[model samples]
Target: MSDTKNKWHAIALVAGILLIAVNLRVPFTSIAPVLPLIQNAFGLSASALGLLTSLPLLAFAAFSPLSASVARRFGIERTLFGALLVISAGILLRSAGSAWALYAGTILIGTGIALANVLLPGLIKRDFSTKMASMTGAYSITMGAAGAVGSAVIVPLTQSWGWPIALSLLVAAPLLALVVWLPQLKKHEHVNLSGPKQAPTVAVWRSPLAWQVTLFMGLNAMPFYVAVGWLPTILMDHGISPEQAGTVHGTLQLTTAIPGLILAATLRRLKDQKLAAATVSLLTASSLIGLIYAPDYAMLWAAFLGFGSGASMMLGLTFIGLRTKNAGDTAALSGMVQCVGYLMAAAGPLLLGQLHDWTGGWTAPLLITAAISVAGAFTGMLAGRNVQLEHAESSSRTSPAIQSANALTAGERKR
Candidate 1:
């Protein structure tokens, strides 16, 4: 009976993690399809819309560095559960009433997501050591798919149910995630994951390789966020209807998922991911070129961009796990990478939006995006090299409690 119960608990834990992952991006992406509607309703300009879209990302940048410390203080499982509740609250508050409510809710959402995003990679590193890539892929697929579906359906839902209610519907995801995550807090109540009393800290900001990974993550994210915030608008500019544009936007997101699924299968055999990273960047660049020069074939460009962006996202996450030997290091690197990376990412939509407003067209902005893709490709090549972050001449200390817990976890995983 004991063994059976433990087995069931393990299954539930995995289910819960996936559930939480799905909630991470839905709140952010759901707003994209209805962006134009919201802008018109609120009487917002292009630059104002960009700020609205980027408000969460700016929150992500600001809050990311605090997540690891917050997790350390509160316990990772409990922290994650709290984050879900916060996300739910943010979603509710976002639709509560005025423009201020919406902006305030978005900041709350970003804060919650920041906590989840930085901590999850470390949790996955700690728990699913052997199947890192596959697990990352699983969660990435869930996240990407949810975002796409949300984007696809939001506009139509707005048409039928109205924008505020349509946006409010997203609260259900985090609420469900919160319920599923409760079991984990109970299971891990006794486990001590807080690091050594005098833990050695690596200056991730100083490490060349860390910077490479951070740059790759940041650069790819810039284009990805830019596309999410404004790609439908760009398509609409090319004469596509709003409904069809939403569908195409959704399709682009779905395309991103395919590489994740494919790579999950092949990751076990793959030791080096540099080529994969380069390929993803190249595909995104090509897509941008197509979008700029061949506006008539926007769907094809969207597909290419989706495939690259999706694959790069997975690879960026996988790099975090692969480059760390333990959970603490994972957390530290995750925090650093996301903090600086997201700060850089926050510039994407804002700058592009301003550029569009100034130039009165998409050409300059698209060219800038293409340049970003090239930069991402270069950084990906450097970041994807087979190297671990702990070997960067940084001292590492492990507490006996952590080591014991790891041993026990490893033994159970073998079962």
Candidate 2:
């Protein structure tokens, strides 16, 4: 009877997590594919349009560290449940009549995501410590799949049900997460909320490895977000219909999503993940070349872009997990990584738009992206090294405990 009850607890935990993961990216990515229609309707400037693409990310960038601190104080269940409700509210507000309401809604949506994002790795760490790689892989795949669906469908929803209704649909997924997760709240309550009591001895922000990881994560994200924010629009510019553009976006997303699952399941945990990092860089470059130089074989370019982009995305998440030793370090490193990383990633869509306006073609942005992929590969190789974040000589991302561990190790060696 006890074993059966434990099994039930595990099912509830997995369901709650998958449900939460589905909501994180939809609101953010769904806005990109519909940008052209939105800009025309609002009579917005390039920067304003950029703001539209970046609003949620900005919210996340500023707020995620707070979420980490709060999780430390409140434990996971209360924070997740309350945040889900906030996300639901935010999604509905986007359907509000005024611009302020829509933006306000986006802010709420972002806060909700921040809470979930901050908690997820810790939850996985706490619950599935033994299966960290597989569980992280599972969550990572769901995240990618949800992003693909969100990006692919927004345009179709606008044509069929209109933008507000289409966006409102995103809220439903999070709301469902709340309902499914409500029952599990009590179970997680008893789980410890406080991270290890020792003061984190090292300053993560000062670490060179931290910046390398942060930049690699950011650059890898740029092409994907740039494509997501503008790919459908770019395709339409080439005379594809709105529906056809959506299909292209969907295809690209599928390419990215499937690779995420495969890499997360199999390739993500390797100590030397630099090879995978290199693969993403090369493929992203090839895809960009095909798209910029050829532009005719849209389908072929999409496949290459998806495969390259997808693997890179999975590696970023996996690298963070694989690099860290405990949940506290994961939380701290993830906070720093995404805070800086998203700020950098937020530029892609907006920059792509400004470049397009200046050059009268997507070539400039495509060329720029090819260069980013190359730089990302070199750094990813460094970050992907087998060393743990805390003990990794001078090359690892910093953590409080890593320095302490180093001191302890050195003292032991001297003795």
Candidate 3:
């Protein structure tokens, strides 16, 4: 009976995580397809429209560093639940059809996602410690899939039901995630609200390996986000119609989930992911070359890029769990990596656009992407090195008596 009950608990936990993962990208992605309609309705200029798209990323960089600390104080489950509420509120607020409401809601949505983004890896570390790679794959795949679906559906939904109803439709996801996650509130109640403070450790800013992971994350994101932002425009410049370009872009996003699903099914751990990283870099480079030179085969090149992008992101996320020894370090490293990494990624689209305007072609921008891919490969190799953070290392050195005492205290807190 106890074993069966544990299985049910695991099921609930997995459901909650997967549901939460789906919400992480949908709020942002669902806006893009109907952006022109939104701009028209608001009588907004190009700069205002651009700001709508960029605000979430800025919010990510601004709010991510605070998430780990918030989780530490409030408990991960409660923090994530609160994040879901924030997302739901943001979705409704953005759908209010006013410019201020739109920007405020977008910021709120970004803030909510940033917290979930930093905290989910830590939660996985705490709960699915043994199956890190597989569970990470599940969440990562769900995130990619949600983005694809959002991009695919939003335009049609807006045409049929109007923008407010269409955008508001997304609130259901977080609301469902909130409902599924309620079981965790009971678990949270068992957790003590406070703990004895420990000596402050040096920040992750001082760690070389953490920097490597952050670079790997940031570099991979640059090409992926750039592709997401401009690939359709690139395709259109090659003589494809807007509708066809949209189709290709959607296909590219859906393709990203393939490698994650395969990884989840086949391999969950790697001593060194250097070879995998190299594979991603090569695929991305080749895809970029194909996109620049062979517009007729855009679908095929996009498939390769999507596969590579998905794998790189999956590897980056996996490292968060593989490289950390405990949940606290996982949370800290996640915050540091995502906070800096996304700030860097947020610049990708703007820079790519500038390159295109300067050279009057897609070649220069893609060449930049190729270079970033090679750098990503190098960073991936460094981050793939089997190592743990300094705090985890020090913590591991504690005497068995002290370790036992700490475990007892943790167990008491559970009671």
Q: Number of the top candidate by TM-score?
A: 1
* Window of ten residues with lowest summed lDDT in model 3: 189-198
Please write out the lDDT profile of model 3 over residues 1-415, one tens digit for every residue: 9999999999999999999999888887667656656768988654465566667788889987777678777888999999999999999999997889988999999889988987897788778989987898788778878877777776677778998899999998999999999999776532222233333242577778889988998898888877776776678679976556666777778788888777644434566777787678778878988998898999899889999988888788778877776666666677687778888787776677667667878898899888998899999889878776676346555679998999999999999
Off by over 4 Å in 1: 125-132, 188-204, 264-275, 318-334, 384-415
Q: Is candidate 2 or candidate 3 better by lDDT?
A: 3
- Separately for all candidates shown, the number of backbone clashes (residues 3 or more apart, or on different chains) is 0, 3, 0
- For candidate 3, the per-residue lDDT at 184 reads 90
Better of 1 and 2 by lDDT: 1
Q: Which portions of model 3 miss their true places by more than 4 Å? A: 1-11, 39-51, 127-134, 190-210, 233-246, 261-272, 318-335, 354-363, 381-415
Work out how many backbone clashes candidate 2 has. Answer: 3
Q: Give model 1's TM-score versus the native structure.
A: 0.83
Question: Per-residue alpha-carbon lDDT of model 1 for 1-415, expressed as tens digits?
Answer: 9999989987987898898898788998778877777888888778888887898899888877777778777878988998898898899998886888888998899889988987787788878889887887788778878887888888888889988999999988998888878778864443334445333255576677778888899899888888888898888888888788887787787787788778766765777888888889988988988888897788888888998887887788778878777766676677677777788788899988899899999999989998998999999889888887654453344557777888899999999
Q: What is the per-residue lDDT of model 2 for residues 8-31, given as tens digits with 9 covering 90 to 100? A: 988988988988888777766667
lDDT of 1 at 75: 78
Backbone clashes in model 3, listed as residue pairs: none
Q: What is the TM-score of each candidate against the true structure?
A: 0.83, 0.82, 0.76
